[model samples]
Target: MVDRDIVGGNWIEVPAGKYKKNARTLSHCQLEFNCLYSDLISHAAEGDYSKMAPFRVLSFDIECAGRKGHFPEANHDPVIQIANLVSLQGEDQPFVRNVMTLKSCAPIVGVDVMSFEAEREVLLAWR
Candidate 1:
């Protein structure tokens, strides 16, 4: 389902049109709207962004398992880890940083993480 209606999103000139504020694109989005990238994921997670919706921000990074030099093809590359800071609208400080993995991984200080036996296990745990 479309999380937010595209018609109500903030419009942009470069992308040319209105789009959802916190929408994730599994495929190509419409040409005429502003779609929120990772920069706006926090807004979606908090469910409130009126105070700081205009600024572009960096959230976290995803680490995938593959050869160093050659990028792994779509079916080969596996998403081995994800780390992010989570803060709600009323929270005083963001503290839900975590890194999930599919194998034994070194613990990141001050962050919660666990390694699973299978990739599907990781997805289920994350959800």
Candidate 2:
């Protein structure tokens, strides 16, 4: 038995034009239009032609200081910096670029550098 409430399960092909027309009329549904939109794109794609949805990607890096000649341990090492870069799916440049440093740091061009006096402050800002 298949659960009809689920967005996907058994495959059934519907014409793109008909699907779009009926999908637009769906309102106050448990599933939002955005979810249906994604489903439609995935289900309606043809050979060598697919709609590319715009999405954002957030990439982050954490810097930690460790003891000499040893790998940084979570309990022992302190996080010195948290760097973040956010960009669109196909964009070459990241629109949001920022870093939260534990202490003083030199200014960087095209990047927002936030230096906090305390480690807690940096962690809070990153959060």
Candidate 3:
């Protein structure tokens, strides 16, 4: 849904026009108005923004969690760490950048896959 109104959102609330909510974050957004726009996404996850002429850009780092140091036999999660965005951005890139680190790295909740124990002694007896 295209929600332009942010009521009691712990942020500013302007009259409804057009806006997009930031992925993985609440109350953060990119406002849509004059400049240039694409109706293609029409309210989806992406908004191609090169609205200005003479696209001279400076790319800040892009952050994401990805797999690295794969050891086939070992069952382990990938190196879950912040990697150098500079290498990822490429040597020719204008700015030296890496994934952004926010002071408030919001709590991320993983899917619940837990089995509750039965009444007292049910689990204890099994052990």
Candidate 4:
């Protein structure tokens, strides 16, 4: 068959052998479409390596206070702080940097520090 290149990639039309009428999975969730793995590989798009897309990346860390000699557990341990840093692709400096602490915390240069009275408040604010 001749290859047809669409806007983003080539289009491959395949016959719906069995999944034509009932397109829902066993869990009763209707999917956009279902196809076999071999069918996908046959119609895979060619990669474009000339340019890269710009996107934001977020990196975060969570600090918890747990019992000594024990791994931190969500139900048992209390989250003390949550630090976040968001940077743009191909950028030198991070666009957003902040920290949410359960209690009062020392200020850091170039970072926004948010202190909450309780752990629930801090977690809620982070969400």
Cα-based TM-score, every candidate: 0.46, 0.58, 0.19, 0.59
Residues 1-127 of candidate 2 have per-residue lDDT tens digits of 1322223332333335433333564565433323242233223344433444567898999998879999999789989999999999999999999999988789989999999988789898887
| lDDT of every predicted structure (CA atoms) | 0.59, 0.72, 0.30, 0.76
Candidate closest to the true structure, highest lDDT: 4
- The sequence of per-residue lDDT tens digits that candidate 4 reaches over residues 27-84 is 4333455655444323345464334457789899999998999999998999999999
- The RMSD of every model to the true structure, in order and in angstroms, is 12.1, 8.8, 16.8, 9.3
Those runs of model 2 whose alpha carbons end farther than 4 Å from true positions after fitting are 1-52
lDDT of 3 at 103: 24
Residues 1-127, candidate 3: write the lDDT tens digits: 1353222312332334445544454432334333213321222222433222233444332232334664422233322223132222324553333322322243333311222232222222212
lDDT of 3 at 62: 25
Off by over 4 Å in 3: 1-75, 84-91, 99-127
Question: Mind sharing the TM-score for model 1?
Answer: 0.46
**Candidate 1 lDDT tens digits, 1-127:** 1343223444312232434544554544433335544223222323353334443232566777888798866478887776677766656667577777888798778989888888777766666
Using alpha carbons, what is the TM-score of model 2? 0.58
